[model samples]
Target chain A: MNITKVLDAKGLACPMPIVKTKKAINEIESGQILEIHATDKGAKNDLTAWANSGGHELIKHEEENDVFKFWIKKG
Target chain B: MTDKKKTTIVLFSGDYDKAMAAYIIANGAAAYDHEVTIFHTFWGLNALRKDENIPVEKGFMEKMFAKMMPRGADKMGLSNMNFAGFGPKMIKDVMKKHNAIPLPQLIEMAQEQDVKLVACTMTMDLLGLKQEELIDNIEYAGVAAYLADAEDGNVNLFI
Candidate 1:
């Protein structure tokens, strides 16, 4: 995926990652991808629900070395 | 969402942890494009207070009431394991370590996100709190107002 920007939400807890991700997503144009690297375990569920509720597209996501990476396309 | 949704939270607890949870939920709902309203009543009104009391003339009983209660989110106590009032501090430190925004910041974020913050006028009068003592930018209304808001809300929570 071609990400327009990357947000480092690592070490942040629930809501903060989502908060930051939401803010970062606004800076990109429609269809542009925003990549978020977060460590909060709850980020996965939160981001999934957030993307769905806001009509954003979760292009891809993966987990490695205890960090969760999410690629969200602005809708 | 295909249609707009609303989340209404009745904040009735003064506990720090409970207030945090309420704000977290409110912020999350707002982030997801949900219209959110937080009705602060009774102890929950403490979350809206200023950190320092604004000097105001009042009767002795009212003064005592104002002085005894927690001033703001930072001064609020934990519901349990207070440990002589140290539990809140410990939890705050832990929250800092985890990089979680505190209740005050969450409240600010809630405001920035346009979450409706309505103070219960009845409770405010009962608690002897003045409008000037709370943080800026909030609505003051009675139960009927909150009910009006909650009536059409898709999510209603009591915390």
Candidate 2:
């Protein structure tokens, strides 16, 4: 899948990761995909809930080397 | 009417940590496109206060209160482990080390996100807090206004 933008939120705590993700998603047009890399454990659930609540779709997410990566399609 | 989800929080504590929690949730909800409101009442009004002295005229009791309460969110004490006001300092230092967003910036972010920040009029009167002493661009209202926003709210919390 083609990625429109990438947000590096590694080492950030709760709310910042999601906060940065929201801001990043708004920069792209609807249907575009946003890639986010974060280290906060809570970002998994938080980003999922955030994407759902904002009408966006968390198409895929994966954890590698203690970094969580998420691909979200903006709605 | 728009079908936006709503989150309303009644900020009733003067503690720094509690206020931080309230703002974190508020900002997160706002980021999720939820209409958010934080109603500042009782000691919670301190979070909205201006840091500098405003030099407002007041009665004796009001003056006493003004002197006793922390001037703003930055000066607020913690609800737990507040060892003679040293806990806030420790927590702030730790937060800085962790790259955590501080309380003042969180409040600013909320305002920028258009989160409706309302100061309870009744509590403001009781605390002798004048609008001039609070930050700009915030609404002033009582419990009825809070209820109006909270009645249909998807998440309603009293913090």
Candidate 3:
């Protein structure tokens, strides 16, 4: 899938990745996929809850080495 | 779904880590479209104090109180391992190394997200903190106001 924006929240701690992702997702158009690159270990669960609560769809997520990547489609 | 989701926190600790935790939760709740309210009382009010000495008229006791208390997040001490105010710096350095947003920035983000920042009126009086001493963009209310906000809140936390 073609991603509209790639938000780098790597090297950040708990809540920072989600916070930055939330801000970055708003800069894109609806239906666009926002890819998040985060290093925080808890981003996996935090982003899941964040995407769900914000009414956004978590299209897919995967871990590449030490980094966790997520693609969210804004609702 | 029709009613607004509420997240209320009663912040009573002046510790840096505790304040950070409160801001983290507030920012997260606000991000998810929740109406967040942070009722800062007692030592927690220290997190909102201005660093600079504002020109405000006060009596001797008030002036003494103002000077005695730590002003702002940068000046606050940790709850443990203080070692005469060195612990905060160590933790702050760790936070910086991990590329985390500091407490002050978190507070700014919370405010920008429309989280209700409130100061306890009774605490301000007890601490001798004047209205002019706190940061901008905050509400001053007593316990009743906090109770009203927390009564129906989905997440009510005390830290």
- Among these predictions, the greatest TM-score belongs to 2
Cα lDDT tens digits for candidate 1, A1-75: 577999999998888898888889878999999999999999898899889888998888999999999999999
Most DockQ-accurate candidate: 2
Better of 1 and 3 by lDDT: 1
Q: Model 2, A7-69: lDDT tens per residue?
A: 999999978898889889889999999999999988999999888878899999999999999
Per-residue alpha-carbon lDDT of candidate 1 for residues B1-159, written as tens digits (9 for 90 to 100): 347799999999999999999999999888777889999999999999999869876788878889889999989999889897899989999988988899999999999999999999898888889899998999999989888878899999999
Identify the leading candidate in terms of lDDT: 2
Which of the two, 1 or 2, has more lDDT? 2
What are the candidates' individual DockQ scores?
0.80, 0.82, 0.69
TM-scores, all models, native as reference: 0.95, 0.97, 0.93
Please report the TM-score between candidate 2 and the true structure.
0.97
Once superposed on the true structure, which residue ranges of model 1 sit more than 4 Å away at CA? B1-3
Tell me how far the alpha carbon of residue B150 in candidate 3 is from the true structure, in angstroms, after superposition: 0.9
Name model 2 segments beyond 4 Å from true.
none
Better of 2 and 3 by TM-score: 2
Superposed Cα deviation of residue B142, candidate 1 (Å): 1.0
Interface RMSD of 2: 1.1
Q: Per-residue lDDT tens digits of candidate 2, residues B1-104?
A: 78999999999999999999999999999888899999999999999999999989899999999999999999999999999999999999999998888999
